[model samples]
Target: MTGFEGKTVVLTGAAGGIGRDLARAYAGRGAAVLLTDLSGEAGEALARELNEAGGSASFFPADLAQPEAAGLIMEAAVRTFGRIDILINNAGFGIWKPPLELSVDEWDAVLNVNLRGTFLCSREAAKVMKRQAQGGAIVNIASTRAAQSEPNSEAYAASKGGIVAITHALALSLGADRIRVNAISPGWIDNGKFGELRPEDHAQHPAGRVGRTADIARACFYLTDPDNDFVTGINLTVDGGMTRKMIYEE
Candidate 1:
């Protein structure tokens, strides 16, 4: 937060959920935020709200599934803020059908948005960051399913797994340019409608509650901050000890 007073952050999936929280957190810390999402209406509203609240913010509507969209997103961000100091590749969705019932198009849809989108955005941002000579950071939003998953999540799991792999590969490729790349695998983050969760949900986690959007947002700040220069190429799992817990039927 200390180093972000005048920085610029380009965040995808900024219409709602974790992406929304990340936008707010970055703006609250004085970063000029360029928010992008498929839901243009919501994204623009959030941007207007943030600007009204005395934060620098703008919105660009994008469909990450399209290959060319990522480049345009980076272009818009640079045009609006002059440069991109951070890139959050968080625009993604999942399909919950059983593997047997899944269609080829469905699988492709998930991969296109989740995996290809991350690559496109990171590639473009890296190019810009290298030119800037000031270095930058990239945070890819993977999922706990990348390492461990339940039924009916084959496509989602594979996409997230790819995210972790690319994080390290990009880190190595971009380290020379001072662009750090990392992934955050969040577990059981309850981004449901308000009041839809119950006490058991909080009690089930070893950390005493399910994950929050702010939890991931804070981790992003830590990993991206220039002070933590040596912390690249790592997949930081932010699960509330759930992944470590062993379960059995009584």
Candidate 2:
């Protein structure tokens, strides 16, 4: 494992499916983790467990929907773990509805969490990194659904599309400050805790099997490595070639 010794990482959605796995993966590499989630108790428990296991971790509670939550989480991270080296904006939300059927509130909810929240976290992290003169990495967890047609998913799709845009835009703006920003478009990752995907979801993919939390988490770890300074402004598709599959008319 790449040693992230003494590196501090702040991860959002740390209590969720992929988020939890990402936290463990980072800690395993010797990084001190600041785990944030809406579930206060769960986040605390997970952080405590990692600490007890000889890894450094701390729990921070925040509702990503709130504008202040992002700043709060980052501030807490800096206070607890010192300067942050990596930030994984992995908090995600989705509501299945067609454009016409989607309520404005639903659209705003998805955008607020998936897009605005990412903006907040990265903005705060950039300020810290720029001041410290230490380059940092940010990994935004988008989804394959961004480019594909998932019926009744207008809001989610738009939000993810925004992530791809945000990653590159921020990457360019932050490049001068020595900060790298990238996004990961995950496939159908079956965490067995939340979310859903029938067997049919996997049959169409070239991988022939649904992805797991570990797959996405592994990618996040790589993107956030301090030793990795060359990679930036990439929307990495970890969707098992599903995006390239030819689904021509029969």
Candidate 3:
């Protein structure tokens, strides 16, 4: 809706499939979007595309794993858009190696980018939001794996679990400032290659289909809307009810 007409949104991992859609969704809603990703080329391209389509968007290249990157990105957003209205902690990756074979370094890498980066970015954004005296929203991209998991997902699962925890903590700490914090746990999101998925893939979920980037985008909008201020400190699972179904093998 036009609710975000004058808002400023800072999104991480802007080059990925879901991130790209997120950028477009905000920009389409009349928000000034500052997109960041390690892949400068992709991020810049997306920004350019949005601008060319008559939307306000800028690109900043930064590695979220670096401690200094969060501050720099927040500064860039303020400099470009004047203030930060929203921060989407969507940058993360998983190293799917068996626990026995997974190195300590690999574990650190996942946690650094996924968990640590979310906290640092949220902290920097909250500072600006507090100063503005206007409440804001921070949505951390967690995953269903936070509560449930499969083999070889130790690092990824742990990072997501941490995100879910940090979300509530931030919510309580920032509640006084009117800054709402929440997390979204997405499951089986089909970023691309939807055509290749089989019938069983869609049937497996109770909703009878996989999720799309739009699903997550809409959820973000709902959480960040000013009217939804009461919906903070919770994790919204947007997985088409896949997480609730009980499947039994015959």
Best by TM-score: 3
Identify the runs in model 2 with alpha carbons over 4 angstroms from their true place: 193-203, 248-250
Q: What is the lDDT of residue 165 in candidate 1?
A: 99
Model 2 gets an lDDT of 0.88
TM-score result, candidate 3: 0.98
Give the whole-model CA lDDT for all candidates, comma-separated.
0.93, 0.88, 0.94
Instruction: State candidate 1's TM-score.
Output: 0.97
For 1-250, candidate 2 gives per-residue lDDT tens digits of 3778889999999996888888888898899999999966789989988999899999988998999888888899889988888999999889997788889999999999999999999999888888776779999999888888668988888889999999999999999999999999997777883346767777777998788888887787778776778999999999878888888988
How do the residues 1-250 of candidate 1 rate in per-residue lDDT, one tens digit apiece? 4659879999999999999889999999999999999955899899998999999999998898889999999999999999999999999999999999999999999999999999999999988999987899999999999999899999999999999999999999999999999999999886755367788988878998888888998999999898898999999999999889898889
Output the lDDT of residue 161, model 1: 99
